[model samples]
Target: MTQPSSEKINDNTSFQAFVPAVSRWLAWQCEMISEVKIGTVFLRSNTANNNLKMFASWPENVSDSIEGKLYDLAQDVIDGKNNIMPKMTCDAGQGDMVYDTTTLPLHYNNKVVGAVIFLQSVRSEDQKKAVFQLFQWGCALLESTLTDMYEEQHKFHPLVTDLAKLALQDAPVALIGHQICNLLAQQLGCKRVVLGTMQGLQVHTLALSNQLRFDTRASHISEMEAVMEEALDQDQAILYPKSEEMFSSVTQKHQTLSADNEDASLLTIPFSNAENAIGAILLLRPRNNPFTKEEVKAVQYATQLLGSSFSLKLRDEYSFLNLLVQSFKKKTQPVFGTGHL
Candidate 1:
């Protein structure tokens, strides 16, 4: 395996350009071909920096660990220096752990946008061939999805593009949270935006675009946070207009929030990843500007796109060196406590 490089990775926000075919949180499909734990890494291309940043990874651990050798080989495939397609890139072992890897470059419009890497535990030539064939099919499926996403990027709204920039920026999480809320309030024409995530049973406010410092004791802030908690507790987006559509048990807090804060259209949507709800956003719009179904759908879709982008940016900001220090973690833990990328 190649040693880690000092190359600056591109913080490509292109993920927002493409609406994923299926929510990654829903169908985070990672398949195994035989005993081989194949990993397909989609790197962000078409950015200023050529160095690849992971888009999605299979076997999950591959997303966190720096697969220098695999990435380097994939880079070679993209550079046209290694034209041989679907070849075993590396066969190595460390202690009892063996990693037999192969690289296949994914090209679009005659340009290599990303690469697929298949890694198996067995070092046998016969097994490597099987993994290659299986990975080829996987590549076909992935490439189709990427092509659709690439096409969708060109049609995305200006706000979507701006959201991409916010996601890619090398900024602190709190700053990013502020930017997201500010952008939502500005472009979406909401009265205000409250962004936060749950801490224990209570919601922890991250950013209030209009208010620099969160007033935890404020009655309105506490009520909005309660509405956020209601949505998170139910694991779904809660729109004040659609309160009647929800279970009666779920409707009480939403009803109370709306009653207390009359006129403003309140909506809270959960920000989730592959596992569970990580955070929520409460958008307050003017009384006259009632939300349309189209608007609701757009908001849901935007959050879906954002959840993955935010997760990647967050991990990018996390210390890979810290992970290296943590005994070469195979599976990434929920990385919090930060440093700059």
Candidate 2:
């Protein structure tokens, strides 16, 4: 399985995203097969009131008894130092049912924050063994999913939050553009990034990474202008699978950077509100790998948020400026300011 990119960690944030990701995965797994009638993940945490809350479910049913049952099972697993459980019986809706089980703890900074209980119905010995193996795999999957979700959230959350805050301010357009470019370069899963804008008849590179260069050479400059304009005119994102080949004739200093310092694949993600193209985000990924669908989707959502915020701020500033002008006009009127005459 493809693991999450290494970025950073936020334990609570990771757990938040992890819980939902695991639940969705369980749902998907059940849909993919037959005979697996039910599945669930149960969690327990001490809330602010010092009461232990049960956040548990079995596919469609979110039962109230899950907290106590899971707390008991969790203690058993921790005390025995075992990773797997089988033939556990628990009350469900006032009746007894044998539940095949596997439990994993949510790790936070190498400490267990909570326990994950994976459950399904038990039938035969062979069936139980197969189910156990599947649950083990699920544990590994959950670990990877949680780690990635946390890292991604950690890396982008600040940027998005900052953008939302900044969008309320009245600032010069050039300044806002520069700040956005800087954040994208530092946060996005890429070595280099560029911010581009379209003028009346020319496309301009608003910002580029400090390490990269752009060819001022006649041939490539025209080509770069053409590529940028196409992206703006079409209002679509562009992904260059082989960025070096795409701009093969251009110099290395101007291309995207990879871990080994090689030229990287490039992605030009367009950002616009309801009006038109505001700008495009240029990102560089590893030479052979490109942005995944999920990453792209995330960036798209961020862009929309940024665009909407920018639009609102601009409208407010313009209104303020108009008010100031009207006030000045009134103050300069003959009756108000020409008192000496």
lDDT of each residue in 44-161, candidate 2, tens digit only: 3421121233343456674546545666666655444765556566665547777666665654444454555655666565444444444443444455455556456322245544
lDDT (Cα) of model 1: 0.60
Model 1 scores a TM of 0.51
Model 2 residue 210 CA deviation (Å) reads 4.2
C-alpha lDDT (0 to 100) for residue 110 of candidate 1: 40
List the candidate 1 regions with Cα displacement exceeding 4 Å.
1-154, 243-249, 309-341
- Count backbone overlaps in model 2: 0
**Per-residue CA lDDT of candidate 1, range 115-218, in tens?**
76666665455434433543454455445454545344333345554664564455677787888888889877988898876565778787887676777888
User: What is the lDDT for 169 in model 2?
Assistant: 39
Best by TM-score: 1
